[model samples]
Target: MFVGHGLGAFALVAFLATVAGCSRERAIQLGIVAGLFAFVPDVDIVYAPIGLLARSVQTVSPDVFWGTANTVHRGATHSIVIGAILAAAVAAWNIPARVSRIAAVGGFLSIIAIGAVVDGLVNAGVLVVYVATGLAIGEWARRKRSSTGWLFGAALIGLVSHPFGDLFTGGPADFLYPFDIVLVTSRIALHPDPTVHLLAVFLLELGTIWLAIVAYTRLQRISIRRLLRPRAVAGSGYAAAVFVIPTPTIHTAPLFVFSILALAIVGVGIPAHPFARHRRSETLVTGLAAVTVGAIAYAAAYGTLG
Candidate 1:
């Protein structure tokens, strides 16, 4: 759920960057909505006891809140069908005349997906019920009104990625929903390499700061766009290695260090290269810089070989 939320937020930023023009106020608004929406699905714990109590009264059995909460994955709320239906209903009632239909669709889908993720998979049990409830409320009150395809796409990506992120961290989101098979991690973990973990953490922090700077500059209309292609290059390198490396391990300090350096070098070189002819140079540069940090972190966890 944590990883999914972060990705969703990142997706929101990317989508906003393209559509909303990436203003500070808009970013803040998106952040707030994303945070609330991300956790909206897990609100089902409130109903577990109710169901249990009802059963107990009807069948002369005892009810346990914890037990009720610990079970129940995807019954109704988590399904894409239900999500769409609920989203449509909400839109019918709440959408403003001035807002774009696309933005409203995106927002509704995003929240509904969040509910599904939280209820059905991200956190196991009766959480789905609560998520459905939240979805109902959120749908009723929803009004931000982006109503665009880009927004919905971003939100959808975030919703889908949430459980995948949790799989890596060994979270129960995968098991939260009994039938769905989504495994992911938050990408933050105890490094397979101790030294690399520490180093990677530091580099990630720096990268975050750098990204903030770039975003701020963009808001200020500064032309010094960040580079991102280098990150793509690093990703390519990593993909290539996956096939070549016989044994898989996260303790790749050398790879992390080298990737970082490669990203940095590439990032610095981008400005002078012909590829930098575009107006969004700063965006690319920032992306590359961030990739460099990712490489560093990977190296810390799984030291590079050769």
Candidate 2:
């Protein structure tokens, strides 16, 4: 899922948290943490070299290490046990403060932990061990005297939304990772083939960018600068991530249509919702736009190279 989607959810949580026990600063902090930590499960991709090495080790000794590490969304890294450890450590290290420092730290930790575990579950569903571990930690976190419920809510939103977003692309999420049952999208037609793949990706990516613009425009009407900062940061990050990756080929007609719709949405819809605290619609639109553009550019480049 695009970080904007996650951030949009986090923004909702943060907004609600502000109405609850958390101060504005704390709520924003939680959103920041949630947005950043939501990317945790993806870290496995960064450690691909380790996964390759582990695959070799598994071939040598399958009984001991179990070859899960070689798979992107498997093992202890995505386990609840690791989540709990992270939550506990964060809570313990929290500096003493009157405003429930432990709660803040613990909340952020749990969100990160759970997000990682659930990411695997969304993909292959075989990640039961990880989910169980995460749930146990969640139970423990829930029992705390100083609980930041909003963080958990944000995490849940992040976990669930990711898989749903991937559905648009029809990519398999490995929802049943550690489990015997695995679920991939039954609807294969939506999945990007090399031919129209770039077109679809361009639509999604451009949509996200448009949504961010909408979000910013909406925030500007209310004159809340802080509310727009995360969107900017997320937008910049998305741009950076896309820039580093190769571009895909996109269909000109679809791209043109998507761009027009995006402009319309940003220009007309956002200004109408000046006081809206959450910009989910905008976020989703922008995310879709970005992915669409990205897929197209990537496909085109690959096609040319091949």
Candidate 3:
């Protein structure tokens, strides 16, 4: 879902921009801006390594490891309130008025102070990273000569749309944050069976990535389907893992993910003509196709066998 966050945002913004009469180049640029900011909320993941390092015993299951890593992942940074404040800060900072700039800085600092009081010094440090990210993006947008409103809209769309993606994978995000409200109380269940549910979520993620790829290829006037190589069929072999590995659920998918992704090697394996000019794109497209094929094969096998 990490990659999905940026790609999904990119697809949505880019497609809409195209429909709304923006030129291809300009639309791609706006999509890229939104995609970059979309990654900002996940900065809380920086705390994961710290959490892991502080542990007395490092040996842990996938569930425990990720549980520890995501301790602060869906908190303040995922909040729409925090996102709005950050977007406003970016907009205010872009204003030419001295008073507006001063207010932006002051408002940002005050938010940091509030975070410190509420979440403590360590989490306050995370807030600093978050605010710094928003400000840096603001500076980049300013350098690009984007209007404040456009930048604000990009930032808001990226930040606001992010937490919603989490509802399908993990605990619901603290969408309101700094407040105790719980808008979504549980992960959305796609199916009654755990395995089927995981497969549904996995397919959804793949669909999102495919959407981004389609949008990008369309913008660039490239044919994504034409880039594939026969090597992609190799990915279907991953279906065998259904019989060998333990059944994977959302909480225990490390093995399934690692094994399936390993099939990507088939794509980049020695080509008939290694030095072909289009080899890179061919291999990349094949790799993605392989993964897609592997997932579908696994899902099919799972359904048939059970």
Candidate 4:
């Protein structure tokens, strides 16, 4: 859910919106908005920097990337109701285009600022001042129209999608602000969780990646095979690496993961022929990738874990 939230998530959403109505080029532009806004909710992490330099940090963790102000990681902006409000506001107002530009800039800076906190590289109240300055300037921009549907759509997609991405990584999103309602509850355990049952989460991420690829490629008239190749190669390659890695202690049986992976690869091949008509290479590559996943999972099972 790391890159899944940023690049893959926003891009996939942008691609889908493009297919919905807007022109491809316009959709791409809106995608820029989606990508930026997707990170906006996390901007509150700026408080992490403010606290550290002031030596009176408002947040407990100071782990800005995951920290929040006066509350938890998923705060107000992460709220669905809040996001809806923001999105609606974006649609309803004819604000200066610069507001978005500065917001996007600040949003990314905020992420970087959070990273700095995580790395412990920040001090002297400098980072706090820096981000604050940027945001402040962004707020003072010039204004335009509310008739365009693009802003609303982009805002809605970006704002709403951000929380769902968090579900696969951390706690559930608080969709209803001030009501204490958790919109998403299941954060299916995965590898990083220090558990043996990593298959479910891994498969979920794999499936998410696949969905993004399939949906976007189809929408853009890009052959699905085009997107699948590199992924298969990469998966197969990683499988190869894992298959040869040194063993670790307390490994759990990953046979099921491998078996399912192998089956999935062959499945990809079967579907390719009907879709692309005699595209044997596509099936072969996919099948090979599947074998790779199977091989990796099988070997990994015997390697290490709790």
Q: What lDDT is reached at residue 115 by model 1?
A: 47
- Tell me the tens digit of each residue's lDDT in model 2 across 1-306: 355455554555555666776755566655544444444444444344455565664454433232343454433333334444444444443334645556645544554555455554333332233333434444444454335444455444444444444444434555543343555544334445544554454455455544444443443354333333223222222333233444433322343334333432321234556335566544444444444443454445545554
Q: Show model 2 residue runs off by greater than 4 Å.
A: 1-5, 11-27, 52-70, 74-147, 168-170, 185-195, 209-306
Clashes of 4: 3
lDDT, candidate 4, equals 0.51
Any runs in candidate 4 off by more than 4 Å, and if so which?
7-21, 54-72, 95-147, 180-199, 214-306
TM-scores vs. true structure, each candidate = 0.39, 0.42, 0.92, 0.52
Candidate 1, residue 204: CA error in Å?
A: 6.7
Instruction: lDDT winner between 1 and 3, please give it.
Output: 3
Supply the global lDDT for candidate 2: 0.44
lDDT of 2 at 102: 66
Top-scoring candidate (TM-score): 3
* Local accuracy of candidate 3 as per-residue lDDT tens digits, 169-283: 8889989988888899999998989889888888888888888888988898989878878889989988998999999998778788788878777768777864377687667
Flag regions of model 3 displaced more than 4 Å.
57-64, 272-278
Q: 1 or 2: which has the higher TM-score? A: 2
Top candidate on lDDT is: 3
Q: Write one digit per residue (lDDT tens) for candidate 1, span 1-306.
A: 333344344545544654656555566445444434444444544556666766575543223554564454323333343334434533443544545446545544554465456554433334334435434544433555544343343333333434343333222444223345543324556566545444545455455445544554555466552334434454334434334434333344344445444554444444455344563564445555556545554453355542
